[model samples]
Every structure is written in structure tokens, then in C-alpha cells.
Target: MRKIFFSGAVLTASLLLGACSSTDSPAPAPSARASHNAADATFAQQMIPHHQQALEMAKMVPSRSSNPKVVDLASRIDRAQDPEIRQMQGWLSAWGVAATSHSMPGGHEMSGDHSMTGMMSDADMKSLDAAKGPEFDRAWLEMMIKHHQGAVEMAKTELAQGADAGAKALAQRIIDAQQAEIAEMQGLLKQG
Candidate 1:
């Protein structure tokens, strides 16, 4: 009887220990385990090149425009967009998706399903590039206003459809920031 009791007690203790050990590590938090979906991937992929184009347009400003406001705006655009481009690229890398090229075979801009609105055509870009001084300033402001509007539109779509919290947050930030920039550009246009 003593032997049987001792064996039963040991078995009970062992089972309890096994159960406790199995639950030692709690399940991951829901937010920590949150996964991205296709909309998030698409937003990141499309926005990367869109930002690169903005940066390109910004780079042209210091060389072409003399207005202090235009120069400052261009610098701000460069600062804001370069990091965003990298962030989106990182998302694409993590998602295991290839970044889409902005160019096509005929040197035309690739819009990636034509969802990329406000994109400057090669001819439009050439026209902007050829303008100097006040002309460049006006053209840059107008183009950037349109570009920012497109960005806001894209961001709104992401916020509506994207699954990742981080991506959705970024989309909201983009909307707020670009909308402010759009207003500023419009003010600048009105001044000229």
C-alpha cells in the first residue's frame, strides 16, 4: 500500500510539472504577431518609386529655381521622402516582394496598373527640367501639388485596405503631411 501510494504521488507531481512546463511561455501578443496582407505590400511597393520620383523632382529645384520658398520646399521634400523610400523598401524586403521599376522599355514612366496618379510623363519632366527661374518655380510648385495629391489618395486607399498597423499608421501620416504640403504649395502658387 505504501509503495502504491508513493508511486501515485510521484506520477501526479510529474503530470502537474509537465502541464506547468507546457504553459511556461505565454502566447505572443496579438499585435506582436500581427501579419501584413497584400494591400500593405502593394502600398509599400508602389509608394517607394513614387517617393523616388518626388526626390528626383526635388533635386532639380536647387539647380533650376531661384525662389527661396521653392528651394526650401524642395529641400523639405527631399528630407521627408528619402527616409520614407527606405522604409517602404524595407517593408518590401521583409514581405519578400520585388520592388517594381518605375521605368518601362520605351523610357516611359510605368504607373503599375495606372493607379499611380499625378505621375509626370517623360515629356512633362523634360518640360519642367527645361524651365528656369520663375518658370521652374511655378512649374515645380504645380507639379509637386499634384504629386502630393496623388500621394494622399494612395495613402487613403492604404488606410482603408491595409492590414498591418504600422503600414496603416504610416499611411495616415502620409495623408496628413502631404495635405499640409499641398496647401503650402498652393499658397506658393498663389503668391507667384
Candidate 2:
């Protein structure tokens, strides 16, 4: 029961945080929320780079991992994030904000850590790229758990502070999805 509740907490955290990040783009002005609240802007700016690193990390797994679980999770991460990146780009353009930096992760007091809270460091990525077989699978799972948690934290901030309806909704979705992924990653960790 305690585990169930903890999982619920993670879920709630994800709903609050995940729905907040937008690697896609800024909200377009013509879309009613043009004059986005400061929170919304911050969410987009921070999320773009946050998602980018996840993509970078996800791409590394296929070649490095031989395990089906690692491959499946990496594929899901890429599939989910690719469209989000495009969506965020569109939002930024419409909002009249320059999506600007593609080089770093989200960095607001909201998203906090740009590297998604140390989920994927330069060394982590480099190590994953170097690893093969089961070793790659283990490293990938460990890094992804942290990355997903970072997303949850950022989403919680958005749910708490963001005024834009769309941003809030997305933040909720992120909380749901990523928390589930965290569970999956944990299971993999136990197996390893």
C-alpha cells in the first residue's frame, strides 16, 4: 500500500510537472493566450532543451543496447518527443517568441535543472555510446529514470503556476506518461 501511494505521488507530481514542458514551441498569440502569462513562456523556454536532451539520450540506446526493454523504451521516448519538439517550435513561432536555443535544457526556477536534473550528463551519454549489450541497457535505464523525474518536477511547477489552458493540460499529460515510464524503469533496474 505504501508503494502504491508513493507511485500515486509520482503520478501526481508528473501531472503537475510533465504537462508543463514544451519542446514544441511557444503558444501563438492569435490563439487567444497570445499575451501568455510569464509562467507559460518560462515553461516553453525550459522544456525545449529539456526534451532535446531526452531525444539525444534516446537515440543512443538503439545501437548501444541489445535488450528489448531498452530498445522499446528508447523508441517510445523518441516517438513521443519528436512531435512535441515540432509542436513547441510552432507554439514559439506563433507566440512571437524566438525558440532560440536548441543547445541547452530548460532553465527556469520551474524546470530548474537544464540537464533534466542530472538524468543525462555529458559523461552519461558518452558512456552509453561506449557501452554495448546488457551494460548499455543498465545505464540507459538508470539515466532515463532521472530524466523522467526531472520532467515530472518541471510539470508540477507548471500545474501549480501556469495560467495557459493548453500548457496546463499538456503538463498533466506529461505527469501521467512519464510517471508510468519511471515505474517501468524501476522495474528494469530491479531486474538488472
List the RMSD of every prediction in angstroms: 4.9, 18.3
What C-alpha lDDT do the candidate models reach, one value each? 0.83, 0.76
- 10-62 in candidate 1: lDDT tens per residue? 99999988876785686445642246888888888778777878888999999
Instruction: List TM-scores for all candidates, in order.
Output: 0.79, 0.74
The top-ranked prediction according to TM-score is 1
Candidate 1: clashing residue pairs, number: 0
Most accurate candidate by lDDT = 1
Which 10 consecutive positions of candidate 1 have the poorest summed lDDT? 106-115
Shift of residue 100 alpha carbon in model 1, Å: 1.9
Q: Between which residue pairs do clashes occur in model 1?
A: none
